[model samples]
Target: MGPLPLNYRRPEYVSEEDSRQEENSADFYDKVDASLQSGPSGTSTGIPDALTFDKIINGGTCPPCTVRDFMNYLIYIEHAAENLQFHLWYRDYVKRFDAAPASEIALSPEWTQTMEEDTIAKIQKDAADKAKKVSPIAREIFRGTDFEKAPEIRVESRDPFSTPPRSSSGDSVSLSGSQATTYVSQEGDAFFAAGVKQPFTIQPFRSEINRVIATYIVDDSPRQLNLSAREQKAVVRALSYTTHPSALRTLSQNIENTLRRQAHPNFIRWTICNGNPARVTFARGLGVGTILVAMTGSIILTLSKAGRGWRALFAILWVIGIATLITAAKGMCVVLHGLHHRHVRPWELFIDDNATGIEQLCEGKRSFDSFDSCNSYEDEPWVVRYQRRFYVRKVFDRQVWIQEPVLRQIQDTIFLQSMLLALLGGGTLTAIFLAVPAGNFF
Candidate 1:
């Protein structure tokens, strides 16, 4: 939000001149500054009304931005990509911790206390056995005395062997967050046996925890988070006791809240300005062609001195042409309105001859029959390969599909605008034409 890094360069380029201008543009900076400010959670998306931040992140199939796209934005635009990386890593770590072995869970402080209690009980039992061997008269004398009562060791609040908290469906509640998540295994859950109060410091987990601390917790480390001294110390202290996932719960929640409040709404706004490209070149071409058809029809009707009804038919052309033109101007397509799919751009499909050796691969290759022989060139998913390229691709690229609710709402609004424009323009023109005689030159 402060002045963006001076080294910042535009990630996507349409032309050299545009890119050059954009890099030094004050307007671009202003737009980014506005996006960073928190206000109504909505941009083009009517947030909390139609779509919420949770839907933006977890909306199945149609989230406004893919996690990859969001990550790229975080990396290139927001420069806080580490928050997302840590958040995702912590989620997976929780799952792994929950599924850990009994031996590993036993390493927790609560379980250690349980084991110590058992040892003490065993020692007391041996003392009682020795007491039993004493003379009957002495045992009888002590049995009736207040001194015969064994001192009770009270352990408060925590029992490692107690069952974990459960939801109505009996699934083990996730200890990390307010939201209930089922991570319970088919076997007796180790989570309950270990207890959530103390840290878990098991072997492999200890190494992994150390790695996390080194990478994310240390102030001088690369991608070190903006955690406070208190929060950092608490996490380290809890983790030292055990490798339990709950140790990092405070840190994870803080980052998640930051993302939801600051990063996420801004991302939705960013998509409205950039990611929601509703149409490509082909659709624009169609719009241009339709406008031409409408012009031609108008010329023919005027020359023919057609009947009033025939002249009135020009409204149909008026509606179609005006609507098409509006969509074209907005980079939207009526046919694809409310649709999550898009045509693959011709350039996306073409392999750069300079970048990759497609020319060499085609050298001795014959068509039709020996196509299978060209299997020497291994193929990776184009999406994966595309991500590796220099360009930060938008969601609207060829073969790309997004069912994002915000995007869909924007398209719906555009479509409605087009229809209203068509109606008002066509209706006004039809009314004027009807007022005059069709055959006259008035």
Candidate 2:
């Protein structure tokens, strides 16, 4: 199986009218229509046609978007995040499958059950015997090794920057705050590290395949995909024959296209709406207040018996006020521009226990627990928490800072425009005041 036919329709969903048509109607579920492409009605999302699905998903030099970013949009903004989740997992799975020894890729069907059981028993006994050979201290040292253990299944935590799980030695292992601890068998790690690959063939890969099936392919799995019943059964049957990644090739193709065509475009629109750099409500209000004060002061100075020189000095205040107002109008902040970061919006954080706005975009109410099943930040690397200590009000107000390059450029442009406007406006006002005779207004 490969990509779904351009006009493919699930058998159960195909109506009599659809079956009679030359081209079957495209499945509408789990998809946004042309009118609902972006956001709320009458809101200008301004999604560019040039920002193609590939560009949004893969990203380019300027946009600073990536697959991870797209997944983030899917999780918080759009629904049906499982497609991308399975797509990503399948990609990694294929790479590992390709690397496995060709001879051991699939188990022998000709082997009797007894023979298979005996072979597995022998391998286990060998592993146990080898483990006993190492001294207790050496075993402890190898067990304490942090570098090569396989990544753990990600736990859903609201805080992406939370600390890693403590080591078994009771030592606080701060390898990176983002990494979760995985407890792999020490004997297996030791064997693999010592250049002795595990002797059992296909069992490990088969076990992994079963786990994937149970997690994402089964009908009631936590992150069950939007695949039709036929598609799901085909995948299960294919994997039963061989644990090769090619078994999932068709499913991967379908999911990849879904993400590229549907999820990617939606993600671009979402980014346009929310990803732009800007000042918060408080900052914008401050700018407005400053403008009012400056206008009042200018009026008072003009009405007084002050000299032209003293009035001219007020040009500085006019410049500051105008610049602040301009920046606010553009939804940019001068201070944030200097800092080179933007605050993550409330919706982006998904702070509400039930993810308040997600359900409004579609019809159904998704459980909160399931929302964490396909998290985008699951295995992201640890970075310096630059915004960790930065806060305005810790309890009621939490600011999460992300350094977005495209948004930084937008901020820079806004800063320049504001300054230019401020300078021009201030200069014109100052020139008029200078030309006016002193005490005329008084």
Candidate 3:
């Protein structure tokens, strides 16, 4: 048959099924490549590009890429699980409350009472564990056991205006260690007292009052009645003589005036208004002045030199001066003031004062109009004004701008870039210095 006529034998033909299989193989390989390109951790290797569709479709393995894809999938699944868990818990809580009767709902707590108990216990245990972990470091820093031996002060107030002593029996208050006591006179001949023990010291009574205010704002439940009782008495006594409008106004105006007189006018304004100006003209001016002085000095030095080589030196100096000026101009001051009051608001100083003021303001009646009304001279408009002013001066005016963590990260990046530029400039200067002849310098 003479090797059979070339066209005589039936050509080996791919069946429709075979062709379909090849297409499927190609599709599978394409998907794998796409997956590898968009792999987690961002960067991708090109090794997968050489893969044949048929090999991948036929179950040829790509271990590294497969492992990475699996990890990425797992991460997505984990996040989804967390989201589902949160939604489920929220829905359950809502449903449980929604089905109850109106009276029952009213009496029912906003938070799940049972869950809250468990959560609180868990939180306490976690906190204790965390504290135990840190206690060693704390002990090292403190370096002494004298904290245990320090006497505690018990404060007792005799009059509304009198400062409370740490000990009622003692003549002088001992302000040592964590255990301290202070006393303040309450309304209508009553006395207010507090006993602070170790690891806890009596901060200013204002802080305690603020905490109470914050608690009332967040959760005004009768469950906090005990906390309210303790805090109300203290706050009422503290505010009895302070927070008058006249007092606040005088104090605030004093702070405003003092801030306005500062050498840095913008800074002063920021202190007073708690507003950040878009441009700090004074700082920029100083930077510009510094650069000008540096450039002038460099020019004078260049003029004194006898050779053309001096031109290179002057150029280097100019570049450095300009670069430094730019850096200074771009760098942000971390500590900046914002428009927020430094001192506690007249209302914030005492909850009782705030409540009484609001009631009086709304009703157009004076506290003295009714004996049943808890009225004090401290609630006078003048006193409130003075209190506001005092807080502005003492608290708000003293505040400075600080870099947040995110801003600090940006600064670090800038610093790295600047460091590289400095190194390059230094290297260029050194090379020029080494290449130039000594005779070129006069």
Candidate 4:
């Protein structure tokens, strides 16, 4: 019994059972791997190549061996989920409608009458309040702003065949009225007499000119209506001469010539002033005349003088003469002063009644006599017609507008001419030096 059955006593070795258990474990592991790869679909899931996630999320395939690809794929899934939710909400909102109709749709006779009454009451109250607030002095100031506050000082017509009736002085009848006055104050300046008629006289300020003109032209208060076309044209022609007397004779002469040639009356009237072209021509002439005078004076002095002293003096005189002539001609006296550090001489005046006439002529239709007719084709309201015309003409017809200013400035600078003469005197001395052979050596 000692070693009795070492084999019987030892635990029996179960090889078949062990083999079966090992096979079953391997099968379980295979099933697990398959489940992970297959998705719910019975087909192979082929878990997108780990690299494919990177390409879809970052626009490129992931590099092999990179763990970041998986993380990126998860981020993309989160973003996609958010976008889908947002799209669903947006679709729901657009499908629904909840808004009231606009107030304009409620406009009816009753509504309109109520609004009109309310507006009128408010306006009347406001106007009355404003009237109470304004002082008598302020009211006077406002009245004076009209350019026509004073009656016309002069009036002329376009008819050349009939001579104007003589006045007491034997000249054409002149309207009796003073020029518009200008007032200055810290607040602002005004131009008008108190209690003056509509179209009051006031110094024209930049801001109010347009407004005043528009009000006069547009308001059909039975007191101020547009004149008929014939009457309007007549007024334009009359005002044109009064404003630009210098141009009057020329205009008259043109009319006579046209009449003689059997031209239409409209054509004759249309030729007044030649519009912008004539002004440009006049400007060019002025420029050319200045140059000629400068050159001619320089030559005369240089030929007359002898010796370096006289020549130098003459050269200086020549330059001065040139400058003076330019100033006298164009009112721009300091053409070379900017380069030479010299002050510009005051400009001289050029008297041309025609200039004023042209301005009035081109100013378009103004409400005259509260009965002037408006050009319906024009886009501007009747009140603004004249003002708009003035602005347009000033900008586009600058040459003509600038003429009076230039002329006036030039007239006041007589000393400029004297200075020019002195310079020419110096140049005469210089010419002498150049001519005398012995003088050149020094």
Q: Where in model 1 is the C-alpha error above 4 Å?
A: 1-81, 101-204, 217-243, 258-318, 321-331, 335-340, 343-421, 428-442
What local distance difference test score does each model get?
Answer: 0.50, 0.49, 0.31, 0.29
Model 2 ranges with Cα > 4 A deviation: 1-84, 104-204, 226-247, 250-279, 298-332, 341-414, 421-442
- Candidate 2, residues 1-442: lDDT per residue as tens digits? 1222223211122222332231223554233233234333212222233344444444442433555566556665565677766776776676786676756655522233453345334444444454345566665667858733433423222111122233433111111112212212322332232233443444537656655655565544556666543344345545454566666766676566566544554554344322233234545666677767766766677777887677777678778878877765555556655655444544433344333566444312232222334444433221123234234441223343434454444345556767878989988887777776665566
lDDT of 1 by residue, 390-429 (tens): 4324334544555565555555565677778888987887
Q: Which ten residues in a row have the lowest lDDT in candidate 3?
A: 217-226
- Candidate order, lDDT descending: 1, 2, 3, 4
What is the C-alpha lDDT profile of model 4 across 1-442, one tens digit per residue? Answer: 0111111111112232342353346474454344334243211221122212222233343221122222221122111121112222222322321121324212211213343345334434443453356466666877857631433323222222232232433222222112222211200111111111232122222123222222221122111112222222222232222222221223323232222222111111111112233233443454456445555544554456344343344454355544444443332323222222121110101113223766544432232112223213234233243344453343233222222221222222333443545456545644644565532222
TM-score of 3: 0.22
With a 3 Å backbone cut-off (N, CA, C), the pairs that clash in candidate 1 are 62-403, 62-404, 199-241, 199-242, 200-242, 200-243, 201-242, 201-243, 344-398
Candidate 3 C-alpha lDDT tens digits along 365-440: 3211211122224445546554455422433223323222222223333334444564476456545544544442
Residue 227 in model 4: shift from native, Å? 27
How good is model 2 by TM-score? 0.41
Winning candidate number (lDDT): 1
